[model samples]
Target: MEIPLSHFEEYIDEPLLKRGLSYFKNGFVHEPEEIRPGDYEAVVEGSEDYTVKLSIRNRVITEHSCDCPYDMGAVCEHVAAVIFYLEQEELGLTQNTKKGSIKKAKASSSKPSKRKTLAQQVDDLLGKATHDELILFVRELAAKDSLFRDLLLASFAQYNPNESKTLYTKQVKTLIKVARGKYGFLDSSGAEYVSNELSSMLGLANHYIRKGNHKSAFFICTAIMDELISALEYADDMDGHLTDTIYDAFDTLATIAQEDPPEEVRKLIFKYCLTSFSKRSFSGWDWHLNFLHLAAYMLSTDSEMEELFKRIAAIPKSSEYEVKKAQEIQYDVLLKRKGESVAQRYLEQNIDNPSFRARAIQDALDQKDYEKATALANEGIEQDSGYPGLVASWYDWLLKIAESQNDTERIILYARYLLLKSHNPKRDYYQILKEIVPPEEWTNLVEAIVQEAMERKPYYRTDLVASIFIREEWWSRLLDLVKKEYTLDQLAKYEKLLAQHFPSELADLYAERIIRYVENHVGRSHYRTACKYIRKMIKLGAREKADEVISQLRQTHYRKKALMEELDNV
Candidate 1:
């Protein structure tokens, strides 16, 4: 789906860079992805912590279902990368000749030359053909559906509900109406055959629903739903990944309600969606999830969904979907299970796990299982009572859940644990702080907490304390921290960490780090983040301030000694 760079520039089409800059204060690192020829689904490194099944085909995106709150928001970077990569690909075509010569020639060929249809063209791109061949094939077939194209570009981020949407917009919707008139509704034998099936599903269902034929609409929609699920089962590489596809189908289905079924039928249909989901064999903690979606569909309406949810809770252990989903969906299901039981079960199963347990807790919390979460947090503390180790898993676990709950005292307590017991955990605490208090609030916390800690001990947690001053956003603090904390000898250690971990933020550090690097570095003043801040500062009527910061950064104490020493050696 990548377009040519020239086409990209001309059309104001957002590249991943522009896209990132739009959404994030700091530019996003767009991890590149590739087309898996085996399935034609786009593939990227999933957040190792969560099981989001993201894929792309044609220039269209189909993301895996995520339990993260952001999932509904379309917040995952994998999805962003998949979508942007597809655009990058479509535009990658602009570099080639605009002759339409390839298209003419491909059309002349008798072979299954791969650009005959949208689906086929997608198949061709996913094939081993060179980039040029793929684009040529696609361009030959690519008749831009203007409204459809816009619907796509608009929905890529999933960052805001008001901005994007849970389903298609008004204009693109005319497509279904237009097509339904052409094709007509009421395909007999309760089966359908159509190209662009999701599209056809919309058209045919709308045709029936528009006529007050809710019976036909529901029937056809269910058939299309079955086919969509069947397609997921049929896809090669993404075969096992049904959660995402199912959710997409669910959301798509939500939009197709021509007339809300009678209260009786809606309840009946809701029960079927809930009860029948157990018939399938779902994996991991997924089996229990089917009900979550079913319940969301019902509860989001005028009807009371709690009794239905209670039925799900009352499912014997003999039922499918597993315990995690059960505990997680308690609030949504209206079962009123304590978050503590859920957390205890999760912790008991996940003991001896470290890097991944955070992921587990986040997922559980995503489900609103606060009681089990509290229990798990308490259990983690008891399992390892020693301060250093206990705080590693336990205190941070509570802080993580507390952040979601906005428990400032819990956040401060965990911050104290890291500051007091493990100086090395400074970086970890700051990273977590971003999730809790945000960047603007960090300094206030630092001022209050660091001062309090200093009264209790000398050197009050050295490793991460310096992180607060790295932001050019807070210039005065940066200068003060550097001047007060580091001696001439310690500058080397401090500068190295800045280069490695805090490079993006250090640009605002009065440019001392960048200036020092100019001597040893061939790319003089080569820091990207630093240069970016300089421009930002200039734009804000702080040109003189910017220059002064840059100069001080260049001439600072032993900060530049390494750069100079290295340049001389070279």
Candidate 2:
């Protein structure tokens, strides 16, 4: 049960794990205390303080819970941070002080002498330096690091108001140039690194905002967004770091725009949004829709709003789908400027698309018009029933409305449809059925779904189906299905699940797999793999079978020295 650093990744999402590592590196986890043997608790500072408790049984985390509102059914960032703190302590990367906080342990001594940090030393020197000397020192420093020079200029550009935009534009260009590699390409990690640097620039922009330099901040944010959008084509941003940074920059601009900025800033934001929208290169992306929404929010004059309407109307209707998206954008803008009634009217006028129909249903629900919402929801499902993905979405909407109205019958009906009829199964649907259906009826309901899935051509064994069987401890049915469809290699992944209900059967299964593997493959590596499985089979009560298989192999492949050597070791 001694957990390695590698095991944590299996229990958490990579992004959350990375964020947790960042938190631990920045000392955000504090005051880890042992509540008792094998149990520890700590507080992690995120958007708010969250307490995390970890139950360590034999050094592996058996259980963890956090007082954070993350409902993803996996470990959250706060709990991950606490786990990282514990990992650091276990690895001797940190030392606990008397106050319970952890700090880096000194290698040379148990207690290290306090010394001024480099920043403090620099501050002391700057405090004693003459004004002329300080100016010369800054000039030299800026010349040494171009990035620092750009940041310095951008940070102080508000004082030189006339040149702020030019300076920021130059900074964006320089940063983009630096981010590109020799072939003008950015890999995923490079994209992330560039994004982190751009985020630091955003930090400087936020500082300008806090200082009430709205124009400077607005220009900087817009420049970043524009340049970042241009960089997207060159970077392999599969992890979405660059996209998230762009969204953050846009949010800052939107927040400032909400304050009713000066006309100049408003026009600049408005123009930027329009230019971004008109760019054909940026089309077919959700961010394009977001840009339209921002432009709608920034529409200050009737003439400006009219211009937006005309521009949207002029977008070529290349396909039915593109036309629908254009109409949706118009409806969003109308919803913001005009009212829900106007938006509904616009939606009705353009209700040819399934997405628009879904929107109308949402609008009905927003107005508490349950009848209208239900009718629209049903209509959407009926029209798009041929498309399982679309029908699933409509079913989800129906379920939402049913839950809001406390209509148990409708909830059960929609949940049943989602469970049985939909190709894509969701666990929440099963949970809903479980909650609303009587306990006596739950088993029958699950059996009916399983039977239905079994009756399908070459039976569909999905995670939902597997989870139901496992949750109910229906081991026989699960094992039959697994044996029918899964190979020996795949079965290895389910040893824990299989061991829970069929230890002897699992042992036999592993023995059969090892015998087949050893007979088919011949090599030192294959022999090693076979030996690994042989050990597992023995651990699970198949020692006799494993010994027989090894004896037969040794006699048959007696001339193979490597195989003989591996078997001897085993």
Candidate 3:
């Protein structure tokens, strides 16, 4: 086995570093006072033609110097050798004893004998030792035994053996020594382990999926997954460190099913991820996130699975099934098996839960139950005062409900409630009301008046805005309003319509109006739309203007920075 600094450190005092350096360069005086109890100096040899001195102080080798002709580099292999020798022989520090038969014999054996030649030593260091031994011998050099260290590292090189043959050179040896200490952390072993297992399991499952072996692959993968669930009981969740090899083993076993991983494999995924099957018997590894996802995506082909999981993971862990990340993992099961109505009711039942409440409100509105949607929105308002949009949404619905029933006073009451309670009265609620409710109830059409007063707004952004503009019959006024709000973002989105086919001049202006409104944040989601515009500017060769416009736009630095980075990538 090659000797590492760590392993060497175990055998010798760390102070030997200084001695090892000196020993590599020149021979040192030999003092066998302890070995003989009379002589006080020992002569050590070096690679270069020189003898070295070693002054021992406080049981430590100190004050070493080499005399090699070209030895400006100081500490050489001769010094390193002397230190290594003392360490391997387990020499005592400042403790001299009676000469034993071994030392007396060694002294006689050492006297003027022909030692092993440099060429023979070099050959032996390379062609024969174990990896551990080879590593050790390299470290023994001032250069340490670097020759063979390079060979072990060649295993990771990308080329085939014929083209770029990876021989175990001393350079490879040195690199492996350094890499194990530092770079091993970057190997992504966790991810690789999971991917490989999945690949294998997928192969087996494919045999079944192909021969219709999905059942065989399915059963095998499912069995392995079950075992993993049991082992993960003793795992770390928050920290992601898996201490149990069985978890790693089981995880690998589960991935082997990726070839024909059945739906059942996907269902048991949460058992490994969320709930511990045993107790905290292991550390959590970052591996689970990527593998479980790969398995689920393979099973479901849901491109949005990863994105939905990202959103779900951010929610508080304590949320109900409708609100939890585990729910997102099993989203297909919930949506496909039970249908949207059932899903909505599940979320609605947990409306008291902060996590599920928002989902319930959206689901109710999406299902078009105006009364149910209105009631959920009202409930959201009482719990979170700042979420005033909830109350306004209900008001918007109520105004229409009243207008449809010809309850004019009720329409007036909803409108007045909206006008009073909303924090942003200048936008949103009025924006919604200006389009949906009848003008008879609005009288002077104050909702239309308020919406038109915005300094900049997108024409096509909210369907409500366009409906209101069309109803008001202010077509020329819309054209004038759009021109005043045009920004560089409009250049491409408009130019494309004309370039791709043909459109009215009014359509181009409509594009500009939408672009400018989006840039200026006329709506809640309008921020950071410069990306769309910046892309077009470059494509149309408006490079100089594109740069200037994006630079001047009132947006985040990241928006501009991201645009530039995307340019470089392209």
Candidate 4:
């Protein structure tokens, strides 16, 4: 989380809060700097110096991280110390005697030698200990700490190695068992811990892959994939950590397939992928078909190719995305098993598949076959008329063909259509229109575009017209748009552009919308938002207007104590 900076201490554990406060008072946060606005970095003195980075936005700590091995809770003491250091003035922190004890002790010591880092201390201790003593200590520690025991076996897999898939499956199950609560459900934090632990196992698998031990890596990857699929039933993976862990395992398997492992290992992977897909182990997920992709790469025999083709053809066309992925996988199989001619034939037959259609169009264009490309694009446009995105893409292809042929009329046609209808943010159809349209007819054409855009619903039309006005330097029209229809959010979004050219008018609009916003909404969040716009008004050289807005809120919403408290901050 995001924690409000004003009362961050309340959200942290009491013990952690005290420790962080002590660290802050002892001046342990060194070289604190605002590296960028709302971003801070500092070296927080802990067991050793740890770098802490914080991203704050709108007076809330949106994200924070520290290079300290503190994962017992969300916010570490080092991160808290840095936050306290940054907000010392706003928080009104003062160093009492007890709080300053650590600093005073350092000040009083005559020979204050620097302390050893954790690594150096560990090395020194290990050097002093005998081999038997080290063994005994480790054995006892491993016996007591399940986490340490699992980590020990995983990290030193080369020693006392059990290169079996069950070895890793047992380790993962133990981790999940330990993380489960009384009801056998993992909470959010527990789920994160399990994900991190499993990820380390996957990392070891990767290491095995690098060491040319494909069998061991395959075992680890498959075990994690199979076990985590079941564990997700009771685990609260709200943060998607567990899901990502499964994806990582899938990706690792893909990497291993690319390595072209030994025949036995490849056969094992092929069987596992086929079994997983048939069992629908990853049903309702894209991985359900992604496993098929891996299986396709592993195909070696004519019978195997036929089996994979049957599996791909059996996949339900439940969604557009899944249908496209399935069709693409089938195309890959055909291309690999048969010749380009056969795959091209398949693509032509399934031209409604956007990916295949796009590929066919590209192939046609690559051969300078504009006629074929034009026919294919027109067919796609007619077939995929329901999908605006696909239609726009087809039009984009047509625009390219026209540009290649120097057909200015078709360019203007396609470009103007895309500008009005296409929601793809990446394409700059507006600029394309400006460049293609002749200078003499530009004004009338732009007016027509504006009228078409205005005919859309207000929610969609306002931003489009406003953007056009901004680009065309129609500041007055933009201001009128905001005044007539823009919400408070929309006003703030476009304020920076209009602030310089129409500061007074924009500020008045903000004042009006702010009042209307408060009249309709309640709660401290709404109050905070209202006050935020008031501050924005002040930033626009309208301090007096901001004050009047505040005055109106106080008189109207005086009974809302939360609102009054928020107003005080403003």
Candidate 5:
């Protein structure tokens, strides 16, 4: 939510706003520091003190983030409290209001003593208790609380003789089940909770790995991967929290593979990888083939290599990415078992794979085989014409080769072409042309580039031409481009950039667009948005123009009560 600092209460939930206001008046919001212009950081004292950071631009809260455990809504009370504290004057709130509210809240409370967090209270109690008392307390809680008992058992499982993967697996499954909602689905919050809990388990695995207890770590990692992989089916996972947990599990496993563990541990992981891959356990995911990548890292015997090759061959060519991965894996296998010469041959045989082509191109470049590199890159450009990003990369390689050979003609040709058309442009190709082209012809070249950009579809090349105008300090031309469109979005985007040079012109354009916007759109939300621009017009030194826009809107939209009400806010 882009919070407009002018009337933030209208944008946030009323209940949330009230809570935030209470928090602000109670002095929970610490003094916010302007870390830099338009950027603020404040610590709001709460259950656990949370840090809130806000980005204010043009008197609007453009972005905000809080490091608190409140994910159910976009704006947490901590963030709101910080916003209120920052915008007190704009909100017509004064220090006396905060003082009076604090006094009122304190007078109404039965107990006004300062609050301590639950962890603080627990620590206070723990510090007073004896060792024997702590032991007795744990025994009593574990005896009555099944959840506590499982946690206790799992936390200390390293000391128990019967500690096994099953124990941790059951613990993780319980977490998933408990986090599920009435619909048997894990919402975003539920998924986040599960991810954090499983991440804790992975942390334990990481501790064991660092301590060289590979077996214990292996049990924990595999247990998580085994259970949570399936739980993802019913999870909303909108934030990819659940998916990240799975990646963390594999990362732990990768650590074990990297460490030269005991044969028992190595073989255990090797077998798990092969079995999981064969069962298509992680199918429909790119990580589906990651099992093969992991097994390749630990290949030990001829039998293992043959079996891995067979599995790689069995992967269906379902997508271009999958096919590329499979061929790359095959090349890696050949490189490992056969040699670079054999791998090079295999790479050439499967040059359709972009990864293989890139490797081959790099290898050619490394050996100073410019002709071979050029041929390979051009072939890739032709083959991957549909993939503009890939073609851009190939052009980048050609540019590199041209630079290597000091081929001026090809450099300008490729650089100019890339500046005009490469979808995945690497850097300032125009700058490269500027430096390389003779100064006498630079202006002409720029004009040619601008004309090329302007000839494309109106919407397609606006950004391209605008980039040229900005780079060349063609502010008038850039303003003209915005005038060609005169859209609210483009006006807002370029207003700040153009305001200093052409304030009156930009203001008039804004007034015109704001009227068109209101004429075409209805409702108070749109009215608020339109008024937001009216404020921009005022800021651009167009007070008269802004007033005219407002008067026209009021006269034209007098019948819309909501519009009239929102305009009054402006």
Candidate 6:
């Protein structure tokens, strides 16, 4: 509530905000209207038009929604552009110079009116351009930019699929070459760039799909998947964007296959999937499993399905991990093809495996057979006796089923076990218990968890204990926990929590950390780090203490010129 214009930076990522601001200034945001008291809507033109809606309460942007396929879980550029527009309007800094011509409002005093934006100028010029002139301009522009040419061709390919098939394939090859760097390595950024380019091709393929050019779409999707998969060896796609893009391409091919494409197209996709799966290099990767799944989906005949399973069974299981993965893939394919009864029988044969047991429990839950689900989960937990992590997962599954059924008693029972006995307990367990248990009982439960953490030898997970103390505002206890020797980094981690609730203690902790930092190291970087802590100490109202520590360190380390130089700089 009551958000100021400056507060926009707080809600949006800096890069996105900058892009949005550029969009606003370039007049990409159009027709922003306050639809209600504190709600605004606008259209932002990017590759396509996107609708942005914002809800303001008091002066703060309380909610933002944008119908753009941006998946970063933050306000998209469209939303940010609309906010920038609203901010400009609020500041009396926007005006329409002519019909449908937006420009920033200028000062009234004698200065010539601000020039129209480049976009505005472009629109005006384009409106005045003759048809032949526009075509000549585009032709010259496309000639100068290969990407422009490729995109133009791709767009045309959607309409004339047969004529542009070779062009589309060439573009895919060019993209792969560009994505794979000179040294045959695509780093994270390279992978991201490649993925984005592949997505553009996907968009074109989808356009073809929409136009009933399934053959062209299938070819494009397969080409993308094949090229991207080859590039995988040359790229460090740790973020998995490139792989995900390829998966999307595979999914597209699956869609085309399912649509009963021509026999030739179906055979092509099937061969690609099966050939990719057969590669030893692709074995044991998630893509390998997905390829099998896709192949299973594309199998149109009983003989094909039987051959698919046979191929999977024939794959060399060099390790138990590979064996398990192959089994899991087989089970998934079986489940998709056969009914639950048949899948259940297959699952029972592999039930000794913890994973299969988990799958069995999930299957029971999916069927809404709560009793069977509960029995299977308990049996899995019992059978996986020595694996605490597996047992914890089973308990989590049970807790989820209980929550689904709203069985509060069972939830409490499972949550208590999870909180106490699970190898890696989640904060959700604490939260669920808090919501269900009586407020009077909540404190005792938290205290017990914290006390158990404290009693563990060599101080186990003090962060968890500290979290509880911070959450409950048990500042004194939190201070006690941090009173021991801690590195500057450790103290910094809790600095804000302590500063807000225990300023005096935090100041003291900073003073202690500052002294330790100076005493331990004599290098320039170390001295700089120590000076940083000293400044933080001073900022926390420990000026006298910080001064004393710095003076002592300066006098003690006076012979070290580099350290003294850093101190002098500080």
Judging by TM-score against the true structure, name the best candidate. Answer: 4
Global CA lDDT computed for model 2: 0.75
Root-mean-square deviation of every model: 18.9, 14.6, 20.7, 8.9, 9.5, 14.0
Q: Tens digits of per-residue lDDT for model 1 on 1-570? A: 222322333332245345422322222223222223212233333333222233333322333332223422324443343334334334331111233232111121111223354465667658868889866765555446654444344323123345322233332233333333323321110112122434544565566466665544454445444443443332322222233434444444454432466665566456546664544433333323654565555544434455555555566665433443554454333333435565456454544344335555666788988767777667656755755564566666676677778887788777656655664453467555556666777667767765665455655644344555553244444445565542323444454444344443443443444354443444334444345545544554556766776565556534655433433322
TM-score of the candidate numbered 1? 0.34
Ranking by TM-score: 4, 5, 2, 6, 1, 3
lDDT of each: 0.45, 0.75, 0.44, 0.81, 0.82, 0.74
- In terms of lDDT, the poorest run of 10 residues in model 3 is 32-41
Cα lDDT of model 5 overall? Answer: 0.82
- The per-residue C-alpha lDDT of model 3 at residue 445 equals 62
Candidate 2 Cα errors over 4 Å, as ranges? 1-161, 178-197, 232-245, 280-286, 314-329, 352-356, 359-378, 393-417, 426-451, 458-473, 488-501, 514-539, 546-570
Per-residue accuracy of model 6 over 1-570 as CA lDDT, tens digit each: 223445677767888988888887777878555555556668998998887766676666665666667758557888877777766745465644336577865342111224553456677899999999989988999999886677677545656635544766767766666655455566555677678887988887787777777878877886776677778877767789888997788778777876877787777667677777776546645667667777776777767777777777777766556656667766776777777777778779978667788777787788989999899888878987888888898899899889889999989889877876654675467678888999888888788888887777664868777877877888888888888647888888878878877776787777777777777776778878888887888788877877787788778778888877877766
In terms of lDDT, the poorest run of 10 residues in model 4 is 104-113
Error of 4 at 431 (Å): 2.2
TM-score of 6: 0.57
Model 2: per-residue lDDT, tens digit, 348-393?
8777678788777887899999999988878887887778788888
Candidates ranked, most accurate by lDDT first: 5, 4, 2, 6, 1, 3
Off by more than 4 A, model 5:
1-162, 181-183, 187-196, 239-241, 284-286, 366-368, 457-459, 522-525, 559-562
Backbone clash numbers for all candidates listed: 29, 0, 78, 0, 0, 3
Error of 6 at 343 (Å): 2.3
